[model samples]
Target chain A: MKLWVSPRAPSPRRVLMFIAEKGIGDVELASVEIGRGEHRSAAYLARSPLGKVPVLELPDGRALGETRAICSYLEGRHPEPNLMGIGFEEHAFIEAADRRVEFYLLGTIANWIRHGHPGLAPLEQPQFPDFSAAQGRKLREVAGWLDGELQRQDWVAGKRFTIADITAFCALEFARGLMKFRPADEGFEALQAWRDRIAARPSAKAGA
Target chain B: MKLWVSPRAPSPRRVLMFIAEKGIGDVELASVEIGRGEHRSAAYLARSPLGKVPVLELPDGRALGETRAICSYLEGRHPEPNLMGIGFEEHAFIEAADRRVEFYLLGTIANWIRHGHPGLAPLEQPQFPDFSAAQGRKLREVAGWLDGELQRQDWVAGKRFTIADITAFCALEFARGLMKFRPADEGFEALQAWRDRIAARPSAKAGA
Candidate 1:
């Protein structure tokens, strides 16, 4: 199997981290340069109509896009270190948490970056006129919410180190690069510690 | 099991259609009026922090949000009439297609509606200030893309009806209430006919 990825992308990073956690290094990597607009090319579009990255091309040549779907497929195929969940309720919990992180945290962060960062202006149409202010506010709001959620748990999905953690961790890290996380905020103590712990994972370092 | 849903929200409609498709009426329905801001209550937030509707509370008191996840859980519990897929590769294909419909079609449409509609002005605060115009353009782009994709297949996931089709059909119907599909647009004939056929389904009628 070959994974088509872009190094600078958050979605592809999620997949790389999952592959690292699975300890599957035998898979080939096909790099797509997003800055060069390679993802919009016809060849890449054949693999993904949305022209996004982190597309997994199976041995049979069929390509699977979507970071979550690809990750889910890998989890099903290699169930040793379960990233999704072990049982039905666990699965549901992990999925619910995962969606929460995606829609709430990651989605907000990505939109902020896409709309705020001048470097990404060309990628999105009709550039957001008030990018910086909007993004700053969104980032603060999302971080506050995520930090509050993290304060009550050891991980994103309660106890386990599931995909929800990975999703949230990746997004949080991505946000940290663009903006500073308020360490003084009482709500984020657990979240800050969790970030450090997750960052120390072998897979996290390897994927990076 | 009980489903917490709203009357006009598309996400709940997805689950309602799934329930109707599976002929499962044992699940009770609980309504939440989104327009009246019932979903924003502290009680509702405890159920789903995102404050979205279509939360399926299980018999065990665990709630599952996100339409696809709820559908997957339902499919797992009721596997006789499978809506996901039959085999591994089929599952991958269905999931991939479902994600495409979700991210590209439904996601875009919802963004357009929530951000663009004056009726939803309260919800557009920090996320989108002038969301309507951008959302309108996004909705058109996705509809055009779906039209092209539909030209090459019988269903959204090829050969059989799956969750992808359900999501797309519901999204398209929802879009119709917002903006009409342009029949004059070339290559949308198949999509138009397909829409008519799916709209005729008893499940579609019953859920709507």
Candidate 2:
């Protein structure tokens, strides 16, 4: 199998970092340039109808998009050093935690970028700064909530590092593209410590 | 196990409908009235940190939130009917399709409601009508895309009905709650037919 990736994007970075942590090998990578509109080409759209990056193409020529789905497929194929979870309820709980961060925090960050950042004007037409400001408030609120969770646990989901940690990790890093952050000043010292710890891992440097 | 749900909501309805589809009989139901802010109760927050509905409380007293994760747990415990997928690749592909509809179509519909609907103003503070209008355009565009796909496949994901169909079904219904819909006039005949089919199922009425 091979993967089409835009290494610069947060979605693809999540999958790449996941692959690194799992010690996945043998999957080939083909780069797609988002700035060049490579992902919008008919050929690429045929693989991913939504024209997004980080598509995993199976041997039979079928491709899969969506970062979590791709990562779940890897979990299915590899099943070692499992980042999803161990028990039945554990997996379900971890997934719930992961999706909470994905749907709220990550999406809030995207809104800030799409509507607030001038650099994204071409992609987000007729941007709305007021809407972005609302999303920014949500980001800070969500960050404050997560700070408490981080203060309690080593990992976002539970006792050990799981997909929840990886998802929050990616979202927090991608947040930097929108604005420079000061975790301590924001009263997110626990989040800062967690981020620092994850950044030290070899998997964090596996982007591209 | 028991579930906390507000059947009127889209996310909770997804889980209830899925349980109906799978003939899950044993799980008990405990309603959470969102209109009354019952979800924000300290007891509810202890189970679901995010204070959302469709939380499945295990026999061990631990609860898991997020509609998809709750459904996934049910799928894991009872693997009959095989709603997730038959193989690793199939699962990934199905999930990709599900997420496509989810992240784009459902989310767009949600934006329209959150930002445009007067009833949601309290939940979505400082709502922006301009952003909602843009998101409305996206909802229509995504509906056009899905109309074509529904014409080709029996279900949203592929040949067999799956979780993807359930998600889209809930989203379309939720859209109507926000505004009246005329599928034929809107040129969404295929989507209308698909909705009708899913509505015919005994599971569809299990929302409450």
Candidate 3:
């Protein structure tokens, strides 16, 4: 199976981080240049209807989009040292936590960049500074909330390191690059520490 | 196990439709009054940090939020009729299709409602009319894309009926109530027919 990804993308980094965590090195890689509008080409659209990066091409020639779905699929095939979850209940909670980070933290950052960043002006039809600023405020608010949550638990979904952590790490990293968001200065002591711990992982740098 | 949901919610309705399809009647039901802000109570917040409904409370006191997660968890435990998928490869594609509906069609509709609907004024602080209007246009654009996809297939995710159908059904139903969007009137003949077919299922009404 070949993985279609853009090195600069956040979503593709998610899949890469997961693969690095699993210590899997055999998967082939095919880069899609997002900067040149390669992802919007007809060839890329055939693989991903949304024409987005980070698609996994199955051996059967079927392409799979969405980072979570592809990660879960990999988890299903490679069950050992499980990163998603262990059983039904664990999977449910982990997914819930993952979605929480996604909908609140990651979603806010994404909206900010898509609508606020000048570099992406060509991508978003009509950029809205007001809307982008609103999302930025949401980012700060959600970050504060996450700081409190991290004050209580070690990981986003309790003890073990999971996909939830990976998501937050990548999202926060993206925020750092796009919005100049610094967790420590934002009064997110716990979250800042968690970020450092997650960043120290070999996969974190390997994927980058 | 107990299911906490609001009758009028779109996400909760997705889980309900899935339960209806699975013919699972033994699950206990608990209603959260979102209009009255029952979901924001201390008790509910303890279960769900986001203070949203449609959480599946496990017997062990674990509460699972996110409709897809709960539905997938249930599918993991039940594994009959194979609504999610039959195997690893199938599961990946079904998930890919599900996320596509979620990120594009459903996400746009939800944003338009949350940001534009006056009934939700209490929920979304300082709503932006311009942004909301932008999302509304996106709703129309994505609906048109879906109409084209449905023109060639019997179901949302290719030929087989899956959870993707339930998600789109609930999402479009929400739009119908909120926006009065009639697929037939808008030249979405294929999508209109698909909606009717999904609505005819016994499970569609059972959970609703």
Candidate 4:
């Protein structure tokens, strides 16, 4: 199986981190250059209908595009040291946690950076400064909430590290790199600490 | 177990339809008036941290939020006539399909309507017409692509009806109601046909 990835993108990094966390190997990596519009090429479009990066091409030659889906598939394939939950109940809670981070935190950061960053203008179609600013404010609100959650629990999901942590870490990393965002600077010490802890993980540097 | 729901909301409706599809009748329904600001009440916030609709209160009194998570939990509990998928491979394919519909179709429609519609002014913090217009155009582009996909497959996730269909149907229904969008009117016959087929299902009117 081959994994099509764009090195600089966040979603592809998610799959890479998951693979590393699970200690999975033997998967071939194919790079797609987003800057040069390689992802928009006819062959790439056939692989990922929406022209997104980080598509997992199955042994049967089918392309699976969603980051969460690709990770879930990998988890199902390699269940040792599971990053998703064990049972139905745990699955529900972990998924809820991941969705919360994905929707409010990561989703907000992506929207804010995409619309606000000058470097992303080619990708955003047309930048909306006001909307981007609104998303920025919303991101801070959600980040503050996340900081509180981290204070109450060790991982993004709960006591144990999971896919949710990978998601949140990647999101904050993106913000730190592009938005120059820092939780500690905004009085979110707990979040900053959590970020530091995750960054120490070998998987954190996966595909960096 | 009680399901907290707001009737007019798309996310809540997604859960309702899933319940109906699964033929699960033991679950009790609790209403939250979103228009009356009841969802913002402290009591409601305790049940759902983000105050989003369609929260499932477990028998142990834990509130499980996020529509997909809730549905997955229910699917785990009731496996007959599965909506997610059968195995890891099918699950991956189905999830990829669902994410495509959710992110491109439903997400775009929600953004467009939230910023464009007058009645939604209360929900959207500050409306941006340009962003709304951009989202509307993106919605059309996605819907057109979905129309082409439907021309090739019978269901949203292909072959059998699944959660992806439910999600796509809810999204299209929301557009039909709020945006006055008709796939056929916009020259998307396959999408219109698929919509009509799903509408004929008893689950389509489950919560409505």
Chain B vs. true chain B: TM-score for each candidate? Answer: 0.91, 0.96, 0.96, 0.98
Task: Compute each candidate's TM-score over C-alphas.
Answer: 0.93, 0.96, 0.95, 0.99
Q: Write the per-residue lDDT of candidate 4 for residues A96-199, one digit (tens) a residue.
A: 99999998999999999999999889899888999999999999899988999999999999989999999999999999989899999999999999999999
Top-DockQ candidate index: 4
lDDT of 3 by residue, B1-208 (tens): 8999887888888888888788777779989988888889999888887787799888788788888899988898777768888776788778888988998989988888888999878777878777878888987778888998898888888879999999998888888888887789888899999999988888777445
Off by over 4 Å in 1: A181-187, B126-131, B181-187
Error of model 3, residue B15, in angstroms: 1.3
In order, candidate lDDTs are 0.79, 0.85, 0.86, 0.92
Candidate 1 whole-model C-alpha lDDT, 0 to 1: 0.79
**Which scores better on DockQ, 2 or 3?**
2
Candidate 2: clashing pairs of residues: none
lDDT of 4 by residue, B126-175 (tens): 99999999999998899999999999999999999999999999998888
Fnat values, candidates in order = 0.37, 0.78, 0.69, 0.76
Q: After superposition, how far is residue B131 of candidate 1 from its true place, in Å?
A: 4.2
**Candidate 3 residue lDDT tens string, A1-208:** 8999887678999999998888776679999887788989999989887787789997788788999999988988777678888877688779888988988899999999989999888778788888898889889889988988899999998889999999999999988887788999978899999999998888898457
Please name the candidate that would achieve the greatest lDDT relative to the true structure: 4
Evaluated on chain A only, model 3 obtains a TM-score of 0.97
- Tell me which of candidates 1 and 4 scores higher on TM-score: 4
TM-score of 4: 0.99
